[model samples]
Target: MSHPALAFSEAEYRVRISRAREQLVARGMDALLCFAQESHYYLTGYDGGGYVFFQCLVLTAEEKPLTLLCRRPDVSQARDTSLIDEIRIWLNAEDTDPANQLRGILSDLGFAGGRVGIELDTYGLTGKNHAAIQAAMDGFCTLVDGSDIVSSLRLVKSETELDYIRKAAALADDAYDSALDTARAGVVDAEVTAAIMTTTLRGGGDVSPAGPLVNSGSRAIYGRGVGGPRPLDAQDLLILEYAGTFRRYNCCIERSISIGGPTEAQRKLHGLVRETLEEMQTAFRPGDTLGTVDDIHRRRLDAAGHAEHRFAACGYSLGATYRPSWMDVPPMIYSGNPLVLEPGMVFFPHVMVGDPETRLAMGLGNTVLVTETGCEVMSRHSLDLPVR
Candidate 1:
């Protein structure tokens, strides 16, 4: 990378290459076809919209320098970012039938009859291009989910990755707090979302060009959007679930505040969730595994008679993104992935308990890092309800 401080350099690139070879060897596979954007960036540091042209890479077990197949424009960018040596260009227009281009590139790379690993979920062309690629690969290559092999390596962060996450968490909290202050009644959810987005940009953060969460009230409770009235009302609880992104890394901080004092029920749930969070943080120390910590959260919920009011996945991984990207916890809190918490990994434990019976939901969260001894939390927000 051009920036000495931010981007990976030649040495780091070699490390990635070594790890790729190791993964291929361990997986008992000889070759791989990676199309996932994150995977692409991880391997090569080439971050462009491959979906536009079906650009992708092929890695061989023979430890050959990686090969990239994409529209002509991406060659230089790829060279700067990825560890690959051969970057092949498609003669066809980027928006045209890219699958044909993919076939040509693959055949030229001698990947004709082998089991080719492909990132199914992340790689693709638009409908037109995808159809063409699908037709071309019909009888040629065997595509499988090669994610596990790569993910096993990516989950462990280096010191550099940790710094980015820490910065991202701070930036997210700053934006989240601003949205909390502006979440008075009569405010639109979109407005709150916009504020967070603007704050990230203004704070010298890389926001990934998209806003985080904007759900108000119940909308905030759902993982996606909270469809409701456009404007909020006094005494209404505006729940905000959002974060700031830095260079594709992201964090999730779920907080809710009342425009005014809370109702009796609201206060109770708020107290419960807040207390839960406090107890959780208070009790957790470094060296706690994912399963152990996840269990503790649930145990407290059970003791409080909230066994059923919890989020499906109460905790998630953190970095320049969320969802599929950040959902990689080793203890399998959500999916039972069983990853040990090393010193560098980070997780945001967010516990949200929703009681539709009272139409009141309360949430508590913190951003934590796994250190050699235990965990260190960087979040300053508390479980108490936020106010203007």
Candidate 2:
């Protein structure tokens, strides 16, 4: 059979699989059942939207080859993108038990009655599916939560990954510029969103799993509001949140703009957000803990008397992500998180503040990569709020 196109060389995949095996052995797990799309792609170069359904990559420390179990429709997808040659198909029939099939593969691979690792916290593994898998493998093996094993390994990116992230960041900057230019009095919110999307795609950005967020006036107060038909008016505040992707790797940015000019109050809020973002950049270093960076931002905002406006988490890891969100795993920048800032770790430090009483909102953020000395702001855009 003819092999499908692959993103990385076969040797790269081999190295990744070898590293995963080492992690499994260290965890005393005979095998790893990866259900997250990011994990499957990281290990096998498999990229598909079929993760909304049930699919898993079974990697074992044994001499046997890895197995990818997916629905029939995604077979070609797996063949096209991944280095996985051993493909197992589960039927769509109601009576068909994919979990049982998974058990058979595990038993065949000599993992029966052994400890197996599963990504229990991922969105790919549904609650019903988890229960079914447990029932199917009841006496055959022991299941342990190894969600962080592969994800942690993915934290530090290689040069190739960094290159893709940089490309994506460039696209994000273009999108931001488009949004700023398109946002003006008498313009519809949807129009601004369209400009951002068009510019991103025209600049070689990949299709995002989630569309860009554009909201104005009252809707702008909510951070995650989607675009609507509301038209911008003079002095209206507009919030834009979007991402750019290259080969599924995402670099996200968020910014706020005023239709005409900002009021003195809005200027104060924007200045506070700008200062917090500056502090975020300065505090992001290899030795600094994730919580330390978050604390720096939080303290600055609290001292500015905008503590109540801040979000629960200031930032999160970013990488190759699918629909619903572009956020990657672990090292959430929040208070009390002990995860250290490591070199090559990319994240988004988003500073947002909203006042319901004043009906004003301001946000400024960019994708940054933690470096040995400090952090590199991947997205190149103005820190000041743009008045269109």
Candidate 3:
């Protein structure tokens, strides 16, 4: 199906609602109130303005009609397409509080001072919005951190969700191809970055998680930023990582290409990361917990003589929309969280452990999905180091 046509279909919305209801019961909650962008998209098909405009969904545990709150600008879309219990609008100024609007809706929906589970992890209720919500509740509502429940609900990926992710991966792969086709001696960092961005847009990509990591050489290897640019030398490492959004689903990937000849150290280190990643892929069974997989990555890194390097920046959850802003996490870096590997959980496994002393960044990641037997690597670009 064409992306534009299937991006927001009603048929897909039912799948999300059904999945969320299962999670709601498991969390032992009466309702799942999602004010975060990613959560909203996961539950309902409201990806308008992503998390910026503050669209929200309130899913009851009983599978009753869901409540949807939208900004005035998005009210029409919510009414037309959403399977919401009651649709309401909350007018929000740049710095004004949106409390009364929030409270009034919750109050009208009978969510008074009870166990109102909410996904308020990322500053959703911390500023003027918090104050408004607090005042509106008037000690009637008890807001609790809902990340655990929300994460549990979204742990497994749906086939439709995978389709969006695959589309995103294809777009990012295009950026990688574009970067290689145009890379050469003396190209500036900005030029390379621009090429990736333009190529992504032309290939039908939307906004990525944090834009393209167009850093080359040393910059590209690290998990944080791109490498330094000195144009492309002969066989120089051209590290490229980027993703484009289709609807709110994001597909991200990173690949390295040598301009002329690959250095022995670069080849060795890149291979090490790849080999280690492959090992992790081998152990990624459907029943393994995220915590266990994280250990597997760290142990592999330590065994490879990266014990001194902290395995801190190596994972992200890939799903409905590009994290709705960087807070969406990769699943491997969990701590005691027992989220099981399912048939459709997509994770951005970015295995990295870089030290500043060497100024060399070496890591690899591709949005992967867990299947019934094992996991599948969505990215196919080869990051082969040089024979030299």
Candidate 4:
């Protein structure tokens, strides 16, 4: 059989798996039942989303081959994309419980009565499946929440991973430039989204896991991308938040466009957001806590009387992530989160300000890479709000 094509090399996968096993041993775990698809992809290069069903990768603390328990459909996905060779299939039946099947695999791997770690913090492991796993492994092995084991290791990127992020960043810059050019009076908001997506894909990037969030007029103040796109008003405010993804790695950019000549208030808001983003970038220093960066965002916005208009989090970590989000979070830039800033850690710091009462919004952001002394802002676009 032909070998599966992996994003990273086999040696890299081996290093990651070895490091994960080391983490397992350090955590006093005999085995780790991986649930997060990111974890599987990171450690074994298993890139399938069968995790939406009941897929799991079982890794032992010892030097044993990795095993993946998934449905029949993912058998090829695992074989074709990952270094994992031991593929176990669980059949679909009205009475089938894959968690029990998982227990049998554990027993076969000599994990009976051993201390096991389960990643309980992912969308991959739903509550129903958690209960089933709990019931199946009850008295068989002690389960501990070791969700951060792999995620912590993944926070610091390798040079190869950073290469992908840099490429993604270039694509994101193109998408922003394309959106700037495509957006105009009477243009539909979806058209702007299309420009962004097209720029990303044509530049060899994958579709962003979440949104190339494009909203206009009253929707500019919304924190999230709402369904349905509408035409731009003669004079409008458009908010754009998007990522360029390469091999699932992401680099994000968020900005607001003034569709026509900006009002005094809109220009003021844009100035404030741009200033806040600049200040936040200046604070992106290694050894500083992620919260410290957010503190600058809050202090500047709150002092400017836009406290209610700002998001609680100014930004978050960015990386190779799956659907539902481009933000690789848990280390979100919020007040009092003490995750220390480290070199090679990538972040998207956005300064977003909006007033629902006035229906005005302004946002300016960029992806940055933490360095030894400070950080490097990845976006090539100017901080000035673009007026179309």
Q: Which has the greatest TM-score?
A: 4
True-structure lDDT of candidate 2: 0.86
TM-scores for all candidates: the values are 0.84, 0.97, 0.84, 0.98
> Tens-digit lDDT track for model 2 on 135-209?
999999999999988898889888888998999999988888778778889999999888978997898778876
For all candidates in order, the CA lDDT equals 0.66, 0.86, 0.66, 0.90
Candidate achieving higher lDDT, 1 or 4: 4
The lDDT leader among the candidates is 4
lDDT of 4 by residue, 1-388 (tens): 4454789888898899889889999989999999999999899888877989998999999987789999999998899988886999999999988999999999999999899999998878999999999999999999999999999989989999999999999999999889989999999999999999999999999988898789888888887899997999999989899999999999998888888889998888888888889989998889998898889999999999989999999898888889888889767889898988999999999988878898878888899999999999998888877789
Worst 10 residues of 2 by lDDT: 1-10
What's the best-to-worst order under lDDT?
4, 2, 1, 3
lDDT of 3 by residue, 303-322 (tens): 87887765654576776644
Total clashes for model 3: 23
Which parts of model 1 have CA positions greater than 4 angstroms off? 1-6, 72-84, 91-97, 121-142, 208-210, 218-220, 227-229, 279-289, 321-332, 335-337
**Model 4 regions more than 4 Å off:** 1-4
